[model samples]
Target: MWRIVAAVVGLYRMVMDATRELFIRILMGILIFLGYVLLSLFIYAIMRRIMVPQKLHTLPVHLQYTPGCSDIQCPFPQAELILNGGKKLLSSGQYYKILLELEIPETNANQEVGVFMVNLTFHSTDGRYLSSSARPVMIRFKSFLLQILYTLFFAVPLLLGLWEQKQVIELVLFESYYEPYGDGALSALVTVQHHGVQLYSTQLSIEANFSGFTYYLYQWPISMSVIVIISIFVSLCTCTVLMWVSDVVRDYDEQRRAALQRRRMIQARTTGQAAQNGLGTQRRGRGRQQVGSNTALPPALEETTGSEISSEETSTVTGVEDLASEMGRGQSTPPPSITPTEGSVTSSDYSAGFNDVLSSLHTLSRELDGQEVGVANRNIRYRTGH
Candidate 1:
């Protein structure tokens, strides 16, 4: 079981080491793609700026005023007026005031008086025109409050769109925390038209109207696009940084694991060595015990044999003394019939038998002592050999 676990761990480590470079390459590729996307978006923004049409809030115009009477020889006939580099035109839903200043000459009292009418016309680049009466005059001042209201009508929505674009940019690009809010795409469209003036004559009972031109105004907020591009760029950078940090962390963890494994291996080796040492010590202890038992056995056997031999010698000696006493008593009673020669022969035989018993006891004691010495010597030799 432990072998299987170790094999699995080794395989995992090998796989990680083999794929480490591949993982890094993949991260780098993602970062590159993100950078490419960011560049493409930047180019697109530039192109859009160059290609997209912008709204023109004003137009230039040239105005010429001619007197109606030729015979009256009116002064300042064919007068040219330039307003705002010519005459500026306002878009529909927009209000502006135009102030015109003209110098007139005082007529002499004797000269004949004549009524003159002048025609004032306004023309646009699109071929639309507006004409005034023979003499131009202001009918009345337009409502200042109404003009302000008209200005606000166009201005408010434009301001709101700008504000919305700003908010969207901030939320999408700058905000770290994510939230699902607002529209994904931003767009704005505005349309405006310019209509020419109307002239009415009470006595002639005639009315004239000029054609006017219409322009369409469009505003697209590219800020959201820019935000998306910026977000991609930022995300790529963040991913790169995170990948680096993760790699560092992984390396640190691997090092730590390696250190731990090394420690475990050292511990295992130490423990195994200790076990072997313990076994060796136990064997030595058992060997010593066996030697001691063997050495002690010989002494005990020798002691038992010596005690038996001593007891047998004591019994023999006692028997010998009894025989000698009996023989002495018999000598007093049988001396009358027995000769001295026979008595001498019997004494010699008894002496010979006692000497033989003494010799036998001496031989037994010498053999016992020699055997005990030999056994002790053998035991000592065996212990030294061990």
Candidate 2:
């Protein structure tokens, strides 16, 4: 009986430990998914910043009239051109396409054509202009490769640390079944004794102590390490896949909602007169409320409620009527009158009373048996003899 009790307690502890681990893993998975999403968004933003086009400052055009095309001779023709939003600031070491448009009025179309040479100039924010020969030149900035390399270097350690922490958690929960050896060394250490000669013996360093505690570290077996690595990779992959599935499901749900909305809109449009009369609106509102109420419960709660209903149904099967019947016919009938025998009853009479009590309790508990009935008979006979 004690062994059974101990086993039950141990099983309960294991269940609690497993439950705790499951919750932790679930929370970690959520956090990992969120981190992955944030990282993806950050990378996308960076790529967008790198790839977006940057516009340069516009160049002013100077028109030089020919000798016969003075204001009085040609009345300098009027022209109009519309340009879109102005130039954007450009980063150094970037290449951009340059476009120049010239519009000449029809009135000067027959005028003497002169070779028009225009000089472009670029001015820095510090009031320094580029030399004439350097017009249309490319600007150079520091290379981004070094920055990327440094980022990767930092990220690798951070990722490794996270992986290590995950492995430590797994070790604490699952891989800690084996106790340390007599000398506090892990099981990986091996020792052999042959004829009082110690052979092939290895021990951990014994000098490491901090704050009254000694710390011993050992390398995990290759198989265990590989398993841990694979498990971590698989878990991360699963989380990513789940994230993608959730996104897809969300999008599908949105589409479904949109389709439903469109259908409702179309229905309302088709029944515009009815809707204006207020009957259709009231019907639709009632339907929506019913649907919302039906869907409001979470899936977990739904399952729990379903289980509870099933349990209640099962429990209702053993009703009070059935229990009263099982208690014994004596419960509903009067007890038989016992005749006096020499001013005393035999042991059999006492045993019969004990059996009746046992039977009643057995019916109530549904677990008592003949073994307890025999034990009660023996006790009653022993008392009667004494």
Indicate which candidate wins on lDDT.
Answer: 1
Q: 276-317, model 1: which lDDT tens digit per residue?
A: 665455435324333222121211111122223344454543
**Candidate 2 positional error at 155, Å:** 68
**How many backbone clashes does every candidate have?**
4, 0
Per-residue lDDT of model 2, residues 1-386, tens digit only: 99999999999999999999999999997997677656555554454354433323343333323344434334232211112215323433333333333332212221233222222223333434322211121112223685466457678676777422111000011111111222221111111111111112111111111111011111233453345445555666788799999999999999999999999998988776643445434334323322222221111111111112233433432442354465355554323444546656555654454444434333433421212222222211001111
Taken over the whole model, the C-alpha lDDT of each candidate is 0.38, 0.37
Query: TM-scores of all models?
Result: 0.24, 0.26
What TM-score should be assigned to candidate 2? 0.26
- lDDT value for candidate 1? 0.38
